[model samples]
Target: MAFGRNKNRRRQDAAQRNEAVKGAVRSKGPGVMKVLALTLATGLLVWGGVELRRWALQSPRFELAAVSFSGLQRASRVELLRLAALTKGQNLWALDVGALERTMLQHPWVKKVEVSRRFPNRVSVAVTEHVPEALAVLGELYVLDEEGEPFKRVTPGDGLDLPLVTGVDREGYVADPDQARQRFQAALEVARAYTKEAVAGKPERLSEVRMEGRDVTLVAASGQEVRLGEGDSEVKLQRLARVRRELGARGLAAEIIHLDNRARPGWVAVKISSPVSERNGSAKQ
Candidate 1:
């Protein structure tokens, strides 16, 4: 009876151990399956992303169909397109937008450029060109923009109808850029103010604005010269208009009008070939 009881207890313990082993395996099995599923999902995502990129690179749907440009004046469309080296049927995703913009900026007339892709097949290039406002002589003729910045070298294809600003040379500009810009700016200011004035019932065009240190002398297309001093350009220009109007009514023309008198404020000196040409007075505007 004792041996049989001992054998029954041993059988019960073996059964319990087997159940615990099975229960532990059941808990660990789901954890292992979850790890494998997560790993497979991650691998599929990576593969899908790589495949999408490859497809986009060679897809006809992403081919470059059209290229558009805006704000182009001095820069021709053909020139810019040649610089970009983009062809129709080329994949848009393959083009480097940053490199394309830098290439476009190599053109002398292009001041600012922005390149963007219109999804599915188009690219646009918007450019801001440097507008030539005047011509300056700095060892070589250069085109000056509205900001008095010399941007481009003068070419035969460029328009030459703009006013000329002289006196600052290339050496001076290279040594002192700020000084040069300020000098050009002063001359440009005078030119802008003179544009609104006319002489002898005819519109006088500003031909040249010669800078001599701080002094400014304006030469018109009509061969009329005005000796304008520094500062108060607009007010002095108004006085110049009145002088021209008075001279025009009197059937006379001044070879030179001096409104740069520092000693006598508001005084003007008019010089001409006629007998009534020697005139000086407070020609207050």
Candidate 2:
């Protein structure tokens, strides 16, 4: 009886140990399955992303079908297209927008460029061109914008009737951009003043604005040169307008008008050839 009881106790202990092992295994099984599932999901996501990228690159849906350009004045659309190298049937997803923009900016006329991928098979380009304001004579003639920035070199038959800005060299501009800019600003100011004072129905056109240090010499369309020494250009210009009106009223023309004296702002020294009547009277005398 004792032996049978010991045997029965042993059997019960073994059965309990087996049940505990099975319960622990059952608890850890779901955790292992969850880890495996998470790893598989991550892998699938990575593979799916890679496949999507591949599809996007190789898919016909993402291929460029058309290219459109806008805000182009001087830059040719065909030239820009050639520079961009974006051909039809090229993968839109593979294009480098920044590179294309840099390529377009290589053209001197383009001030600003914007490139974008229009969804579903189109690329769009928008450009802002530099507007020529005057011709800056620096070795070769270069186009000066309103901001006094020299943007492009002129070719033959450009047919720009703008004012000429002299005394600005490439060396000066390269050595001191700020000083060059200030000089150009002053030149533009002088040009504006001249333009504002129109005689008759036509605008007063300037032939050239020569800069000498801080002083400026303006050559008019009528072959008269005005020496406007620095300080208070507005006042000087006002006095100049009066002088011009007086001369026009008397049907007189001056070879040179000097308004360089600041203290005598109202005074002007005009050089004129003696009239035919005065010359004939002097001859008779």
Best-matching candidate per TM-score: 1
lDDT of each: 0.87, 0.85
lDDT (10s digit) by residue, model 1, range 1-285: 999999999999999999999999898989989999999999999999999999999889999999999999889989988898877888988989999999989898999999999999999999999878899998889999888999989999885689999899999999999999988888887887777555333557889999988889999887888998777988888898888889888887787899999998599999863444334543322
TM-score of each: 0.82, 0.80
Error of 1 at 107 (Å): 1.4
Worst 10 residues of 1 by lDDT: 276-285
User: Model 2 segments beyond 4 Å from truth?
Assistant: 1-36, 199-203, 273-285
lDDT string, candidate 2, 47-131, tens digits: 9999999989999999899999999887899889888787899999899999999999988889999999998899999999988
Q: Using alpha carbons, what is the TM-score of model 1?
A: 0.82
